[model samples]
Target chain A: MRVTYHAVYLFLAAMLSTTLFTALKLFGVSPNLFIIYIVFAGFYVSKTEAIWLGLVFGFVYDIIVGANVGLNGVLYMFACFLVVVSCENVIRRNNAVVTFIFTAVWTAVLEGINAIFGPVSGVWPAIRIIIVEIFYNGALAVILYLALKRIFERLYDNEKR
Target chain B: MRKLFGNRIFVLLLTITISVSVVLGVINATKTKSTFMGNVAMVVITPLSDACTWVGRKVSGFFGYFGDIDELREENEKLKSEKKELEAKIRKSEGTDRENKDLRALLELSEAYPSLELVSAEVISRSASNWYESFIIDKGTADGLKIGQGVISGENVLLGRISDLGSTWARVTVLTDSGHSVSAKVIRSGDLGIVEGDLSLSKDGQCRLSFISKNSDIVVGDYLETSGLGGVYPKGIEIGKVIEIKPEVQGISQYAIVETSAEIETISKVMIITNNPAESTAVGEE
Candidate 1:
């Protein structure tokens, strides 16, 4: 992807994640648009490019949110790293099933990390959050994947032309 | 090992991962929101964040105005049920001067407390993290705001406090946010416990009232209010309702979960109790 495209893409993702995503929460859990975007973009891009984009945007997300500074960046960067790594080594293609599973695993890992460091009352409750969020994020990820695929496909075509 | 280190992406990932982890450790250890990088970024990011929040809220509100048929149907059913209950209660109380008594009581309450300085503000943005609950409101030190002031939805409902502030903006960490604690009591039984926000129950719009004794008379459906023990949150503000209770091995409560009365998401405007009457009294005494 062009640098400008990446810039615009992440910018839109951050705006949505912070505002629209937070506002339109379903069952009080909004989709983590940053995570969704990074994961989606990571699939189509080179490993180095994906990691850099993730690192930059992850830092931005962490700074803006500030629950734990650098924590969001760490998790998101790793999530992108692992997803791209998985694509090369594990998954054959970025199909719906693969994307769903990747999103689910990525969400679980991030939630686990968040829970470990986050405030908690019990294990079961933390697990409940992880489960609920994974499903919410996973479902959203599939839809986002298809939409992004269409958009990126067009962008690639434009670049080729 | 040489070849692994030779690869640039791996090196970058490893370096960033360690750097960010170390940074997280440092930030967590010392102070909140004091990082140099963060402070510098705020110069540019703050306005963009504020605008995004503003536009987001407006757009969402615009859409929310269009009623969803299914939600409306459910609301209609709920309202119809509530109407029946209200009618029954109204008929039962037809002979009494209850309305007059209630008004007189309200009048007495209004007279008892000293006049509070309230600053009206608009909610501009929500916290970027779901794990934590807070939002930015468009009022700050410029408007006589300070740290630890109480925020409310309207009259009696507790919202949160001004955790951090800019010159003209402040972040109100909602009562539902984890790491937030409110000293509150069960109004019915006078059972006292600290209502604290827990991340686990946050998604369900609930908080936890901890430190209730083993044999406290607290029960389900008991109303909770700010106990005024802490002197931060004003006394007698309705916080939430007890939804569920968790018990320890010895039958003592772990905590009682409370569903907050304020829907922090949909609220566009809030009232800040800029100067608590109790705090003012303390100031006067000294």
Candidate 2:
């Protein structure tokens, strides 16, 4: 994918994450679009490019959403690193189930890190948050991943491996 | 594997980024004031979020109007009766006000406390993070909104205070945030206690008033107001009403759960008190 397409997706994800997702909270939880974006980037981009994308998106999300700076960045960067590294060794299966599972795993890992280091109310709330995000973000990841895959395939069929 | 580690510059950049991020996270988490980068980020991001919030509210409001017609009619009838009663009281109040003006002048009570200086601001967005109970307002340093200025409902109910700001935006940490604490008193009993946010209660738009002496005659439905012990907030602002009371686990004291008159979750606009009367009193004492 081109850098311009990456930038547009990142901006849209950041905007929706901070605004619409906030108002649409269910049981005090919202779908994390950034995690979905990170998952998308990991599969489509090189390791270095994915890492940079995650780092920038995380920092931007933190600044927009959190009083505590850099926490999201670290979580996102680590998530991207893991996702990219896994992709290198793991089979590149372009399917909804695979995308959902990948997103669910990363969502749990990232939220777990956030719960430990972030100001979570208690163990129960943290557990609830992780479970909700895993399902919500995993479901979103499947739909978004499929849509983006179709769009990218149509735009640059030869470029897609 | 050797090639991955061989890129010294990439490794160095990664290390530096992580180190800086950790330092910044620690600093921002610990500090009360806004950091430079935070302000910069707010400047860039607030406009986008604010615009999105505006659109979201408009769209929601349009849809909500159709759904709310029945509720609005019921409320309108209730208000019609209340207005008639209020009009009758106003006539009686005008005569009492004339008599009290003379007594007020003699006591010089007005000199003891000044009226609040407030600025109206619309809430642009709420905190995206679940951990923090806060919201962004469109007014900021440009509008003379200082950190710690109290944000309140139109009826003067205490909501929160400005925790941080950019030139065009400010973040108000609500009373339900775990980090927020204030000294408040029961209006009915004059019993003083500390009002603070608990993570458990906050989700339900409730806070707790702790350290109430076990002997005090506090009850559910009692009103609570700021005691003005803390200089950060002005005195006499209504915090909330006590909905429940419970003895402390240790049996030494008790606490009361407070529910604000206006629901914190649905608040869309608020007034920011630019001046702290308590601070002015301290300055006068000094």
Candidate 3:
């Protein structure tokens, strides 16, 4: 039930990324909202749930964006797994700063995977785009992280009850 | 065996690794067509994307009205003068046109090609990632579109070819995508070359014309057009103007950098030349 509710939000993220977010391009790149969502799921939800959501919705994102299937799914799965592990063992903190930092880092990872798997001819240009996206997604986290956290916590509590 | 199966992280990693391998294999095997899930997703999202774009345009136009009054006035004056000049030219050309038509009839020449049956489409959304230069249009197989059919701007500039299609939408791989290439010629010198996308140059909204002989007569300001060598795009469609020329790393031949004629970043509409006029089921035609 919880997964279904979050799945709707995931679909919305994918839809917006292709629609309105496309108009929000900064330096030829858009923020990977899926990365932000996956990180949130990792920190707030259980590791297993986060990984499942990442794999499923990541593929959905790729399909909607008209990209190769499984590329983003695997990358997103790995990101969720990494974040869950890091939260439990390394960071042990769930705050706006952590969300900001994780979002920035994961955006680079996901975009890096795309550059490697996609038909990128040059390295420097791809790097520049990745850097811009990191900053863009990180800044978005700083602004929306608290709200997102609150909403997810409330939903998770309801699911538990 | 039970202990390993119970290890949650281990099972998750194993599942992910297997899924990744399967995906890579499938991608390699079928790189041409969309998957079933992709088609389903397109069906669900295309309408929403179209609606969003419509709303976004209206909203932006509403906000822009206040700031555009002065620019509109200047443009209106310029358009008025241009309209007068065009009207005079049209009046002068009417007689010439009739004379030419008579001469053509006398010479027993049929029109070179039937009037093009073009299906106009609106760009619904762009590629979500910046790595690929592509956009989804609001027409597809139901509109008589096919893969490899040339998409063009209203001014007849070749945008790209239909790379993939669904029932209601299609994806166009623009001239600047790394995966795209077109056979082209210099209109002035008639030197033939292959115009293709390079990742580095695509960032600057440019493509490279390669395979020019070391001593080809191509120059920086030369214009490029489709050579009709490839069956995909028809001949004489304007591509772009050459901006620069550079030597290949092997020092054997040089390539010219061509700036696309159409400002691709801002284009909102395109016309796809239907494969066959008879095949075109006009959207609202009986």
TM-score of chain B as predicted in candidate 2: 0.72
* Rank by lDDT (best first): 3, 2, 1
| Interface C-alpha root-mean-square deviation, candidates in order | 2.4, 3.1, 2.7
TM-score of chain A of 1: 0.85
lDDT score of residue A69 within candidate 2 = 71
| Prediction 3: B-chain TM-score | 0.73
Per-candidate total of colliding backbone pairs: 0, 0, 0
Give the CAPRI class of candidate 1.
medium
Fnat: each model in turn:
0.59, 0.40, 0.50
What residue pairs clash in candidate 1, if any at all? Answer: none
What TM-score, computed on C-alpha atoms, does each candidate reach?
Answer: 0.79, 0.80, 0.81
Tens-digit lDDT track for model 1 on B76-139? Answer: 6887787978766755774353434434434443344456566777776677666778877777
For residues B2-114, write the lDDT of model 3, one tens digit per residue. Answer: 66467688587767756785677477446778877788889888998887776655444454455468997787688768797876665578546544543443233112233
DockQ of each candidate relative to the true complex: 0.50, 0.36, 0.44
User: Which candidate achieves the best TM-score against the true structure?
Assistant: 3
TM-score of 3: 0.81
DockQ of 1: 0.50
lDDT of 3 at B218: 88
True-vs-predicted CA distance for residue B252, candidate 3, Å: 1.2
